[model samples]
Target: MLRTLYRALWWLAAPAAVTRLLLRSRQERGYREHIAERFGCTAGRPLDDHAPLIWVHAVSVGETRAAQPLIEALLQARPDARVLLTHMTPGGRATGEQIFGERVLRSYLPYDVPHAVRRFLRAWRPTLGLVMETEVWPTLIEECQRRGVPLVLTNARMSARSFRRASRFGAATREVFGGFSRVLAQSPADAERLLALGARNVTVLGNLKFDMNTPAEQVAQGHAWRAAFGARPVWVAASTREGEEEQVLQAFAALNVARALLILVPRHPQRFAEVAALVARHRLRCERRSSWAVDGAVAGTAEKLDEDVQVWLGDSMGELGAYYAAADIAFIGGSLLPFGGQNLIEACAVGVPVLIGPHVFNFTQATADAVAAGAVLQVQDAAELARTLQTLFSDKPQRTAMGAAAAAFAARHRGATARTVEVLLTLLP
Candidate 1:
């Protein structure tokens, strides 16, 4: 009865959802481009006759990137396997294009309505489905189950807040979660949460993000950026969310440190212009990476930013490594207001010390482990962030030691992708 009602509610909300998508398209035009795919109405490119399809649904950029190592492992293990990648966001689709090119099939996932999911499954007929992280759609799972297409939840996690919300539905939550053939969790604590939610087959497979190898060129670019900064103290506020940027700007304003340069990277591509406007509103001179010419110049060159440019807007996609490499300290955003925080593993992988806000329930275990490893520091608010940055700026030795610890912490967590791939192999047709 609950499941039926849920579907009914979703069906009733279809018009509103379409309107929402239309509204979002105004800011992000890519959302408007793939209209047919979202309803599972269009036929994608014809499938290969010799190879079987292995589907992976990564909701956005983060989960898509997290699934990278596992995706590569699947491809290497079975050269005959064709990948069907689906994403809810344009960023994920763009990242998929950049990484996998024309090798894999990419599409916008259908809305979690029954008919759309059925149409999607009917069209593609994926042999196995791997839903990255906690993107469980009840109708989609039900359809997959009914169709005998095995589905596995990979690198799964649940924050306390998310757990509470799921628990409210009682058996409905179980019905959805129990549909998964297996749940590979990031931590033991995550496994416990899944078990309590009535997931029968849950295993702690660590974090797939740890296995994501940083591109060497990206790291080198980071070194170049650091060199470009010369004697100035540099820090990065990476993957920052909506309200948090204001807090970050305010904190930087309070410090009034002339030599301290901030590389501010907003989480969403659509917000680049907005963030730039905010920087201007704060009366801070800033240069955008997107606006930078391809003929790269150094600190003393003609193309160099004026010393008055206080913040460097990291507006480009897929170059986070460069920002982290150029920083003395790193602040992982999305934590300041209550958005569950962005991934800190990338920062750690680049050997940068991290500072985050108190709300990191999404990365609960990783955050705790990092702090225990002496890799990350948690601050209460923006004022505290300013004060902490001030202290770290004055002490170079502490930053170096912390960076080393961060790298070590990231290194120790490797091998999850291998474990995850092994489980995936078992489900293949």
Candidate 2:
């Protein structure tokens, strides 16, 4: 009865959900590919038949990125073990498929209704289930437990705000969380909170995100971008969200961004057109990143006073490493306008000078440590953000020094992947 009620609530959230979906449908066909996930794909045939599979759910791009090393580790350990990947968003699914390529089987997670959960489980019949981060589906966990499937939550975290809300439904959340055989959290803070929520066997395995190994190919590509941009002081607003872009654009306009590049990559690729409209509304001369070099941006020059603010609309997908590589300084977005901020660890791990806003609750543990390591600069608003960027632009020495500190912080925090894999191996049959 409780599961049924919770499922109803998910259905009720659909109107607001569908409304957003309709708004994002303006993208090209390639971007709209994940629409099949949310709608339905009727699990037709078993894609991997040789061995036992593990279903890992990563809802969006961030989670998908975090899950990469774990997925690779799994593949290494169990040559016969299959990965049946499912993502809530199309962008995530695309990224996973791109990263893993044909090495793993991928699909959309069925909706969380009992029927959908049953349908998903029956089709995959995975021997084990692992959810990255805070994806606690009551029905999914309960059903998996019923089937004797070992369940685990990897590199998990729950913010203080979320802990409070989940505490409200204390009984229910606790019962649902208890279904997990293991909960490997990013911090002791996260583990303690999960313990409060009735999750047993919780441990602090640290952040696997910190264990993010900068891909060599990505660095090589970044070097290529660095050559193309050629001494034009550059900064990237990587993973900017709806309201955050306007703030970044407005600040850039005020900061004489015409002289340098103010690149904006929306968190979701679906929002590319809507963001482009917002850019044009600001009257900035914008160009798609896909058409790089075609815009004929001359190197080693400054924007004239009368020139329009040349906003590089980063419409391309799955090349963030390229963006990070291209920028001398970086602002990790989602913090300024409040989505708890995107992970600065990505930019920091690459040793790029990093900046973020105050609302980095999502990465509270990691960001706090990064700040202590002098790996990040916190800007209160657009003004300070501009000043910070300006300072970094002029003070190349300081920026380079900060970048090294960030990389060291990243280096010191690796090994979580091995720890998590060890946990997974212990629980698996």
Candidate 3:
């Protein structure tokens, strides 16, 4: 009965959702493409009948990237398997293309309405489905169960705020969560939360982000960038959310280091121009990454950039590893104004010292673990973040030690991909 009403609500809201997507396409044109897929109209080539279809749904860029190692492992294990990857956002779809290319079948997951999901399932007929992170769609789950598709919630995490919200739904939440055939959590705390929410067969499997192997080419690109930089102290503010950029720019304006370069990469591509403008407002000499590419390559020598450029706006995509590699220190964003922080594991994987803001409820266990391992330092606000950057910039020995610790911390948490793959394959027929 509850699900019926929920479906009704979604039916009513479907038009609004379509409108939102169309509006978002103004900033990101990828949304404009693949319109039919969102409504469950899959017009692509027919699926290969001989190969087993494995479906994985990742809503956005982060989840999509986190699913990388797992996807690769699954493909490696089942050579005859065809993975169907679904995402909600244009950025996620774009990132999928950038990472996987023609290797995996990609489509936008339909809005969680009965007809759309039914059409999607009918068209694809996946043998098993894996929903990444915390996405729980009641209608989709119910439909999957009705069709006998074994659905698992992989790399599951439930933050305290999320737990409280789900608790408020009482039995409805439990019924939805109980629909999953398995729930592989990132931590024991996450497993406990999932169990409390009535998810059965819950297991703690650590974080898949920790298992991400930095691209060797990107690492080489970072080395080239660093060489071109010629000893300028470099720090990157990676994946800064909306409000956090203002604070970060303000703090960068007050920094006292000589020839220091701040690389600001906004979390959303839509805000790239806005962030570049913000840097100009601060009166800092800025260079846009998109402007200076040479010979069809994104990164060229630093001589292309003005010596006085204080900020290098990271406006390009799929080069985060290179950015982290080029940096002496990295500040993970989305935390300064309470958006729950961006992933610091990427920077740590590159052996760069990391600093983050106080609000990290979204990544509670990972952040706590990183701090305990001395790979991360938390600052309360922009002021403290600036102060820490200044101190760390001057103290190379401490930064070196912290970088080593960060690398060790990342190395220690590997093999989640293997563990997760072993568990996932067991569920397959």
Local distance difference test scores for all models? 0.88, 0.80, 0.89
How many angstroms is residue 79 displaced in model 2 relative to the true structure, after the best TM-score fit?
0.6
**Pairs with steric clashes in candidate 1:** none
> Which pairs of residues collide in candidate 3?
none
lDDT of 2 by residue, 224-253 (tens): 656655557778998998789888987786
RMSD after Cα superposition, model 3:
1.7
Residue lDDT tens for model 3, 1-429: 777788889889888887887898888888788888888999544765756889999999999999999999999999888899999988888889888999999889988888889999988888899999989999899999999999999989999989999998899999999999999999999999999999999999889999988898888788777766666899999999998888998778678899999989998999998888888888889988788653312445544456788899999888899889989999999889889777889899899999999999899988999999999999998889889999999999999999999999999999899999999999887
Q: How close is candidate 3 to the true structure, as a TM-score?
A: 0.97
Residue 45 of candidate 1: its Cα lDDT?
Answer: 47
For every model shown, what is its TM-score relative to the native structure?
0.96, 0.90, 0.97
Ranking by TM-score: 3, 1, 2
Off by over 4 Å in 1: 45-50, 294-302
TM-score of 1: 0.96
Alpha-carbon deviation at 76 in model 2, angstroms = 0.7
**Collision count for each candidate, in order:** 0, 0, 0
